[model samples]
Target: MQILEEKTLGIKSWSPEDRPREKLILKGRASLSDAELIAILLGTGTATMSAVDLAKRILLCADNNINRLAQLTVKDLVKIKGVGEAKAISIIAALELGRRRKSSDADKPAITSSKLAFDVLKSDLTDIPHEEFWIMLLNRGNRVVKKQKISLGGVSGTVADPKIIFKLALDELASGIILAHNHPSGNLEASVADLDLTRKLKEGARLLDIQILDHLIIAEDRYFSFADEGLL
Candidate 1:
């Protein structure tokens, strides 16, 4: 009887008009907030709160950024009052599916300009807290063949060896390559090390009959392109 009482006053107690699933069906998914969509995954909540309320709490913890939420672990989600291991796993799984769909292989865009190249790889680098160097191997037509992480380092800097960069480009039979790294400091200004490395790699690529298309410095919301700045 106690269990039945608890169940009645949870999501089942809400009006059909107020239920997340019912609201979604009637009004369409675009009408729902991030919390509302997350509530659908939650299914139900503790006796003291509705699923929507629980989801709201979770989003609040992540500052309402889905990308930030994606970085969370199951333990992180379960730290909330109304969430348990099962509900946490469900949320993580749903977010991972969304990420995989966004970066699916069927949608690889070509690198026609520095901006286009920046758009292709920004999502992978922008939110990272440390330094990372990646090489985008491109075919003769400038279409991306592969994105390889060359190195990862601390907040200040990372090592990008020209020999390894050229070797990968040669192995892949790439005609061009775009170099990219993130500045966790949010500064778009290229450091002395950045400029020096770009020159060295450009020289190496020229020797191998491959083009060094650009070097991009990624920030949280913007980027600096060496090619765009006429520095490449």
Candidate 2:
């Protein structure tokens, strides 16, 4: 009976050096496998399986793709046995922290032209399904201070208020600003409303002594630049 009990003790039956937490401490976090890292987040196993085994199953379900694992919703995670709400939340929080760490470490580059602006923002805006207006605030040397989402709306259009924009500019002490918005329809032409808003924002920025660099209309694979067209 002692042998049976010992056999059923799951991860504890392994040597201490083989345990995920113990291995991480001995070899440093960078040396641990993906399953071991997830096992640490889970912290415990089910009655029949070890935490590492469960983590391995989860990774296999994602086809060993880290991005697919990161995109898993809590509902999707809880479909697996032993991954209750608490465990699901823990996994999600860990993934989000990793994403934020990468974003914080990335250096914001200077915006030199409309082409550069498109290159910087295309990846973020191109695949989004709905309309979103974003602002890139810059310092005196054209280095990006921050990127902020101003508004979100349906497939048609979104609103961008001049007062709210300048408020953020005031808060960030931005010397120059570039406005960008996406068209979900994949149309690169600027709408009448788009041109009107650009003019209003330009007039407003001039009053505040802040330079309005350009207004960009982002589509699926192309963009329209107001400054490049001599509209700014």
How large is the C-alpha RMSD of every model relative to the true structure? Answer: 4.2, 5.9
Estimate the TM-score of every prediction. Answer: 0.84, 0.64
What's the CA error at residue 17 for candidate 2, in Å? 3.1
Worst 10 residues of 1 by lDDT: 1-10
> Runs in model 2 with CA error above 4 Å?
1-9, 105-132, 154-159, 178-232
lDDT of 1 by residue, 1-232 (tens): 4554433357666788777898899989988889999999999877778888889899999998987898788998999888999999999999878766655556687889888887777767865678999989999988998888899999978999888888898899999999999998888999999999999888888888999999999986689999989998
Instruction: Give candidate 1's error at residue 192 in angstroms.
Output: 1.5
- Judged by whole-model lDDT over C-alpha atoms, candidate 2 comes out at 0.86
Q: Name model 1 segments beyond 4 Å from true.
A: 1-9, 73-78
